[model samples]
Target chain A: MSSEDLETPKEKGSTGEKQASEAPKPVLSSGSFLLVDYTIRIKETGELVDTTSEKEAREAGIYDASKLYKPRLAIIGKGMLLKAIEDELVTMSVGESKTFEISPEKAFGQRDPTKVKVYPIRKFKDVEAPLVVGARVNINGKEGIIRSIGSGRVQVDFNPYLAGKTLVCNVTIKKIITDDKEKVQQILHNRLPDVDIQKFTIELAPPEVVITLPEEAYLLPNLQIAKRLIAKEIQENIQGIERVKVIELYTKQT
Target chain B: MSSEDLETPKEKGSTGEKQASEAPKPVLSSGSFLLVDYTIRIKETGELVDTTSEKEAREAGIYDASKLYKPRLAIIGKGMLLKAIEDELVTMSVGESKTFEISPEKAFGQRDPTKVKVYPIRKFKDVEAPLVVGARVNINGKEGIIRSIGSGRVQVDFNPYLAGKTLVCNVTIKKIITDDKEKVQQILHNRLPDVDIQKFTIELAPPEVVITLPEEAYLLPNLQIAKRLIAKEIQENIQGIERVKVIELYTKQT
Candidate 1:
C-alpha cells in the first residue's frame, strides 16, 4: 500500500481508489547511461522510420552503407530516445523489452495545412520538366515533397514527412553504462562513427585527458573538427576535466 | 693580394691564375639562413622574371595580392633558393651586394626545340573558340603557353618561359635569421603566409616542441593538412626535436 493512501485516507475517498493503491513504483535513475536497441515505425502507414538493427533496416530497404548500425546510448533524461519513450523507460528495468504507441501530440506533432503551398514552376530552377509528383526538393533550405506540377504552377507540401504520425516504438534495454572511461569512448564513437574507437588509447588524468588517436584517424575527412568536437563533448559531459589533449603521433613509414 | 703568391707558387703556374687567387676567398657558411632581396630579368629581351620587392612587382604589372612579397629566406645549401645564386652569395659577405649573370645551363635548362609540339584543338577540352594566343594552358599536368590556334590545330610551347635566356640578377643580402625559435616561426610563416606567425606561442623542451596555434589558424583552408605538414617540417629540420605537438586550444566564448 502507498504511504499517502494509508497515512492520509480521505473520509470521502471511494473504495475502488483505496483498493488500487498497491505498492510504490520502481523508477530508473535519471542520467543513467543506457544502451538500447530500438526500431521506430509509423503506426498508420507501418513505415519504418528508424532501426538500430542492420537486418531490420535491410529488410525494410532503408539500409545505408555509411551508417553504423549498433545499439544507441541514451541517457535517461537526455530525451534523445524520444521523450515519451524515455518517460516510459524510467519505470522499466534492464533486460526488459517493450512495444508502445506514442501519439502525434508527443511525437512529431500534427501536420499544419498552411505549410502546403503553391509556387511558380520557374521557382524550382534545378528541377527538370515532366517532374515526378512525389519527388523531394529543398526550396530555400526547407525540405518538401512535390504534390503536383500543372500549368506552370507547382504545389509543394513543406510539413515534415513524419508529422501527424503515431509512432510504434520497439525498444530493448540492453545494459546501463557505469564505467566512466567507457562512457567517454562511447561519446567518441558517436562523433567518429566510422573509426574504431577501441584502437584509441585514452589516458584520463583527473583535470586532464590525453587521447592518443589511431593512425587511421590522421587523414579522415573533417578529422580535426571531429577531434575538437570529441574533446568538447568529453569535457562538457565527463566531469573533472579541465583539458583534453588529443595527440596523434606520426611514426615514420618505411 | 694573393696569399698563394706570397707563400708557395709553383714555377709552372701562369701569372694570371696566381693574381686571381687573392686572399683565400671568403665563403658564407653552408646551411646558413639568409634573407635576400632580389630582382631577376631576362638578359636578351629584358623581360622581368621575378623580384622580392612589392613596388617592383607592381611596376612590372604582375603583382598578385595572394603572394607575400618580401625578402626570401634561403638556406645556403638548400636548392630552393637558386643554386647559382647561393654559389654567388657565398663569395659575397653581409653588407655587400652583387649583380651577376646566370646562363641557361645553370638557370633553367636551355629550351629544347623538340619540347614544342602541335596538337589537335580538341585535345584542349576546356578551351573556347577564338582563343587568346599566348594564354597559358595546362595539358595533361604539363603547363604550356599557347602560340597559335587554327584549322583544328593548336601550337603549344611547353618550354619554361625563362629557358634559353641568360638571367641578369640584382640582389642584396638583408639579414640572416640567427635565433633558433624565430627560425621555427619563420618556417611556419613560410607555410602559412596569410596568418601572422608571431601570434603563435611555442614552448621548446629538448626532443619535444609544443606549438600553440592562434585562433586565426583554426579554420583555414586545409588547416588539418597544414598542421600535419608543419609538425612534419619541424620534426624533420629542427634540431633536438623528437616530437612536435601542434596544439590548438579552444575556449568557450562568453
Candidate 2:
C-alpha cells in the first residue's frame, strides 16, 4: 500500500484498475476437490434435513457436540452431491454462498404405489419382539414398515422415508484443497467421524501417504473396512496418492 | 448275468477293447476347481504341519470331531496351494495320490536377520499381562514374537513361525467338482464349517444360483462376509453362475 501511494503522489489516473487486471482469481471447475459447508432442507416445509455448519445447527435446536461441524470435502462430478448441486458448483468461486431450490424429481424420486404392500400378521409372530404399527420390519431380506394391522393382516410401505420431497440447499465453498495430505485426511475423517481429526498427522511423499492414527481409533470395530473405504476415497479423489500406510504407535506409560 | 458275459460269441474278440476306447477320462487343468484331502509335513523332522483328512488328523493326535472333514475346494493356479503343489496338480487326475517335496524357498521364504530386532525391556511393561519368551506381541501394527529376554533387552523376531522350513505334502484329489450346484454347496460349506452341507439346497438356473440357508446358519456372526466370500468364490470358479441368492427362512415355533 505504501509503495503505490508514494509512487502516485496523490494523483493516480488508473492505478487501481491496472492492479486488478494483473491477477485473476481462481474458480472451481469439474473434478476439483473442495471443502464446503452446506445446509439442506425441505423446500415446502423449511425443515432442516442436514447441515455442516454449527451455528445453523444450534439455531435449529439440533446441535450435538459429538458430531463434528467442519468443512466437508466434495469432489465435483462425483455424484457425491445432487446432480443439480454439482452442476451449479462449476460456476462457483471460493467464499461464495448460494441458495438453490431443487425440485422433487431432482431430489428423491416420486413415491410409487407398488412400494406399499400388505402382509400376513403371522410374519411378525416369529420375531422375538412385539411389532408396532410404525416400526420397520425386514421380511425376506426386504425392509418395510408396518403401516396398519387388522384382522390377521398387516399393511407395509417399502418406499424411502424421504421420497416425493423437494429440497432447499444453502451452500458455501470454504476452501479448495490442492494439497494431497489434507485431501487424504479429509477422506479418512469422512469414514471415521467419531475419531478426532486433529489427532491425525499426515506425511506426504509423492504416491505415498502415511497416516498416524490416534490411540482412540485403534479398537474401533470394522477397522479394516474403514481402512479399505478410506484408501478407495483417497485413490479416487487425490492424484499421486497411490500407497497409504496407516501407523499406530504405542508408547510406554509414564 | 453280466452284459459282457451275455455278449454274442462273434463280437467277443474286440468288444471289450472297443468299449474302453469309446469314453474319455477327465483330467485336472489349471482353472479346474477341485475337492481334495491333503496332509502336509516337514520333511526333515516329520512334524505334521497341516492336514484336511480325518484319518490323518486322528493319527497325528490333532483330530477334533467338531471340525468338518469334507473335501476342500482348491482352484488350480489361484495360489490357494503352494506354487510347487499347484504346478504338480495339473498333471494329476481324480482319485490319484502323490507325495511331493517343497523347498523352503518355494514355500515360506527364508528367514532374514534384519527382521529380528532388540528393544528395551521397558517397552513391554505397559502390556496388561506378563510377557513370556515365546508369546506373540503386536508392536506398531506388525506381529512378532518375543524370542529372548536378557540383560534388560528383549529380542523380537518378526519372521513367520513356519519360515525357512521345507514342506512335504501328501495330496489326493478326491473329486473335481464339475457341477454348479455341488460347487456352490462346497463353497458355502467352506465358509460355514459348522453347518451341515446337506442342509443347503441349491437351484441353478444358468447365471443365477439360489441357496437356502438352514436355521442353524442364520445366526452366524459375520453372515454378510460369508455370503460375499461365497459369491466371490462362485463367480471366480463357476463360469456361468453370476448371481447368488442366500435365503434364510424363519417360521413360528410350536
Give the number of the best model, judged by TM-score: 1
List TM-score per model, in order.
Answer: 0.77, 0.46
Shift of residue A63 alpha carbon in model 2, Å: 5.9
Q: Over all chains combined, what TM-score does candidate 2 have?
A: 0.46
Candidate No. with top DockQ:
1
Reproduced native contacts, each prediction = 0.04, 0.00
Over A9-69, each residue of candidate 2 has an lDDT whose tens digit, in order, gives 1112546666578543234566677777799998777888889988889999999998888
**Residue range A1-254, candidate 1, lDDT tens digits:** 12232222122334676557684343356666677789999998898999999999999999999998987888777666789989877776666689999999898899999999999988988755345698888888788999988999999999988888999999977666666687778877877887886887878887777777776777788876786777776676676776777766644222
DockQ, computed on Cα atoms, for candidate 1 = 0.17
lDDT value for candidate 2?
Answer: 0.74
Pairs clashing in candidate 1? Answer: none
The residue-level lDDT of candidate 1 at B92 comes to 65
Best by lDDT: 1
